[model samples]
Target chain A: MVKKKLIYLDNAATSFPKPEQVYQKMDHCMRNIGANPGRSGHRMAIKADEMVYNTRETIKKLFNISNSENIIFTSNATIALNLGIKGVLQKGDEVISSSIEHNSVFRPLMQLIKKGVRVKFIPCSEDGFLDPDDVEKAVTDKTKLIIVNHASNVTGNITPIKEIGKIAKRSGAIFFIDAAQTAGNISIDVKRDYIDMLACSGHKSLLGPQGTGILYVRPGIELNTIIEGGTGSSSESENQPELLPDKLESGTLNTVGIVGLGAGVDFILKTGLDKIRNRKVFLTIKLLKGLENLNGIKIYGPGDAGKIVPIVSFNINSIDPSEVGYLLDERFGIMTRVGLHCSPLAHKTIGSFPKGTVRVSLGYFNTEGDIDYLINSLKNILKTKA
Target chain B: MDKELKEECILVFQTTHRTLQAENILKKEKIKIKIVLKPRSITTDCGLAIRFNAEDKDVIFKIIKNNNLSLMGVYSRSGEKWIKL
Candidate 1:
């Protein structure tokens, strides 16, 4: 039997069909230049070491970071958040977060509460828009960190990160941004945004492979190291080196994955971030408009395509989201995500708790035909009660 | 011994990243250089050092200073001890 074509709309979860160069470079690095970076003095090790640095430089260019050493690699955004959150907050410290945060941020803040740390979760509007004023109102003298989700996973609503970052600055608190959803999809400059720390997944919009994530910390803000091991520097001292990356990054790096990430970033740079984002937004407008015209369909978040990322969440009248998702896949070979999307607070805020909305996320690779197919599929499902 | 001493200077940096960064900057400038393991006698943060011709010392120092790289020190070997240049 021939394989069915896949129309993947789960870019919010992880991008699919990465650029050809990503795959090619990863294979090349694995086959030929596979060596432990920063561990050996051999030629292959040096090559591997240079590959890692070059990837870091590419990421630095993408995010407009000044110092490449400040960027640390982790397994995923979750680990990066853990490192930043647990490393900064201590007993009696206060934190300010949002209601639309993913489990990565929500769970860590919850864990910190058990240790006497306080957190204020500013609620967003029903449409999933977080107000900068609400964040400013929650600030206190004890506030040590102010972290916000750059965009909602369920609603795809983009928050006013720059305004909120200024609030953190005035309050003398560290501003951390969880850019898991918007890192590569939108523009985020650490200097312009006054961001003290930012963490994001490389696999999502960045189009890198799994097991790659990034955390950028500003120069002055100090965080306790959560994990420490050999950084291939200052080997004489048993203690971890007191430096930028070596202080945070430990153990062998994912050379194959990092090299692939470099190629992915190179593709973005050559193609232009604005061009890639515009393509996604154009398709999203079509999807949102089509869903609005369909009977018995209620879209979530901002109905405006310009206000959100390339994601659409909606529900059919009285139909279970899981069933709709299943039929869309079983009958049409369309892939999507249903349920809370690991954001229970967002579900509750949008009044989709227990039952969640079907999220259709677009990627740079998606086309107009994919959107039309999805809309037709949903219409067919609603009409036939599939 | 005089000829050998005039030919090479070991440039050490604070971290492997700085060492590699220095290597990149110097390589682009067309400097004749080699990455070598740090000598046991020199105590530095990174385990690698760049070995270049002693004649290029003035230009190398200028480049290092302009780039703002964390240069730990420069050293040359004497009969038994490593002397700081």
Candidate 2:
């Protein structure tokens, strides 16, 4: 009996198969040293703690962080965003953001808007690009932090982080980056980029297990804790351990995930992140060029080759994103994500909110053949959309 | 044998071990590379290295050479481990 193959184009959500090495590493950790990290003097516990520490150290190197201890572990990008938004933001402070932010970022900050903090969002162009000049004009004295996604999960548009960081620096507002979409895909140096606090999801581009994330807190910027609890160190004190990681990490922490994350960062350092990013850009440009020929397919984001990652968001004319998603799922067996993609404001900026765009996000393993198949599938789907 | 094996620590990597990477193999797999860590000698440049593995030396060097990449260093487990001639 022959079997129908599954074409996975939904890479922006979570990576697939996990490069074999990732799976093996996670399994080895779960099997060998499944001990509570930072708890005991035992060898297993020590090893586990070392694994988490080493992971933080690796992340420090990956993003060119000034200090290893400054990197903190969180549940995911959402949690990190909440922590950054909630911790540093006092009521009545102002924030400046781009329209192209995941709701994970927008919602938290938006929640504080009603509580006295003024929030201003810089609009993206129809093609999903944010302008630095527009950001410059939007800045006000009350603006405490300028939060924006490094790259859009929906449209793959990369904001001019450096230019905006400069604006924030001049205005005395801290720059917080949602590196959820760009962390492993693009090159980001906290020092060079002038980002004060950057949130990253380990599972997406870094190929780590779910529940693993990183928050790079630049030195001299202290974010108060949203959750306070035991940090293996400073047991005598009732206060959350005042140290960097302990202050950020409130509980037992995801040790196995962090161990895997260490390996993930090590992998990126070995492979050279620029090399990985170029391959995705190559495939994405190819996809864009093909979509240009097909009728009824509307592409979003700036058409510039180097402006984004492998993620693409588009839709067929008059076709609901749910219908498109179902057809790709049930008929074509090509797994693609559709709808608002948890970033309704971004969709609204691109004018695809209520019924959103079908997004195909590529990764390191995605090849030209995969792009071709996706293009062909969309073409076929378009022709049959009676 | 035990001491030598302990000295030669495996530098676990995410990508293929053959690929040129940031981590290094410490010289003298059994002993930590003390010279690299002289007091006040670290210039914010100290990085991780496994106790050196001799066999991995040539391949790693060749990768850097072929890729036109420069690395920090390479070595093998040493309590009298042979150096490349």
Candidate 3:
């Protein structure tokens, strides 16, 4: 008898069945170093501080940020994006971004537009890669920030950050990247590419716990803190004392989440981002190779295989993206995420913004066998209709 | 062919990057120093600890600190271990 179980392919959303070490390490930290970090002078507090430091250090190595203090924690990528976008942006300053950004970048920039900040969107092709020349043309004297998504969640295409970063530098605009999709799966070098701010999700790619991510701000650039509360370092002052890490970080820290994030980074670092990315690319190539022959199924993004990440977005003809998602989950016992993916512009650029597409994002733990099973399931579904 | 040859010196910083930044800054100052990883005896941070003759340690540390830069443990090698000043 064949055992029927679920196969989760929505890693672009959140990873499930985290490594045993992630849960175990977080459990041990909670039991032992359960004190408030950066709050007290006690050993537990110090241990908590040390734990966060070690984790942030590991992340610095992961992202290749020369200074570990530059990695500031946020509740998530959305909050980090909001903090990075809204804090530095001022009235009348123009910000240029792409048409494929997630709501995390779009919503904040849109809010800035409402507040008198000018917003411009550079168009991306239907396949999802942006035209860097369009970005070059968009820059003007008023432009202060250039925000872009590292990879499209809708199409799994990568942006030419190095090329666009040069454009921003030429225009004297601060370049901010929403690295939610690429954080753990790809290697990011902040200095080599001249990146100003990088908003990351600890949970998604880094395999860290949710409610914990980082916003990497280059030193010497100051932004107003969005939320203010106790920062343990400078309690004696009434005003929020501006300092590295603590200046941008406010309120009670997510100590346990941060600790788990550290362990997760350790895992990512050991596995190596290049190896992880290659594995996902191999799986995506395998699935795409199998899928191309199937009738009634349409695929998106570059076919070179290397151009795409582990993510794959597709739809079956005569079926709604949501219904395709539903059938895959209910009838197939395979968990998948469907719909606009919160990027209307991405959909608009790809001509599926309103209707959306079914997204399958692979992660480090997934195997070729998993891809084979998914391919079989999809073949079975579309075969009946064919 | 006669560029001013300022003596190369080692500079320590509070932040992990300062020691290297010091070397770069010193290059502009026409002074040079070989920056190396800070010894674990100073701090567990991945910060750099450089080596040069003893003459430049005080001035380098003073310049690095005066700039409000990060410095962990700064010292010169007395054979093997980094002896902190």
Q: Pick the candidate with the highest TM-score.
A: 1
Look at candidate 1 and tell me the lDDT of residue A385: 90
| Lowest lDDT 10-residue stretch of candidate 2 chain A | A38-47
Stretches of candidate 3 off by over 4 Å are: A1-3, B1-85
Give the interface RMSD of each candidate.
2.3, 12.7, 10.0
* lDDT scores of the candidates, listed in order: 0.90, 0.75, 0.78
Highest-scoring model, lDDT:
1
Q: Tens digit of lDDT per residue, candidate 1, span A254-287?
A: 8899998888888998899999888888999999
DockQ agreement of candidate 1 with the native complex = 0.48
Q: Compose the digit string of candidate 3's lDDT tens values, residues A264-330.
A: 8888888877888888888888878876867787787765468876788888886888887887787
Q: Tell me how candidate 3 scores on lDDT.
A: 0.78
What RMSD does each model have against the real structure?
2.2, 9.9, 8.9
lDDT per residue, candidate 2, A1-386, as tens digits?
Answer: 23446888888998764667677778899999898765553557656666776787788888888667678899898998898889888888988988998999888877888788888888899878889899899998878999988999888989889999999999999999999988989899887888999998999898888898878788788888889876655555567755576688767888888888777778888898988888888988898998888887788887665998778888888888888889878876789899899999999999887888989888888878877877787788888875
TM-score of chain A of 1: 0.98
Span of 10 residues, lowest total lDDT, candidate 2 chain B: B36-45
Best by DockQ: 1
| Rank by DockQ (best first) | 1, 3, 2
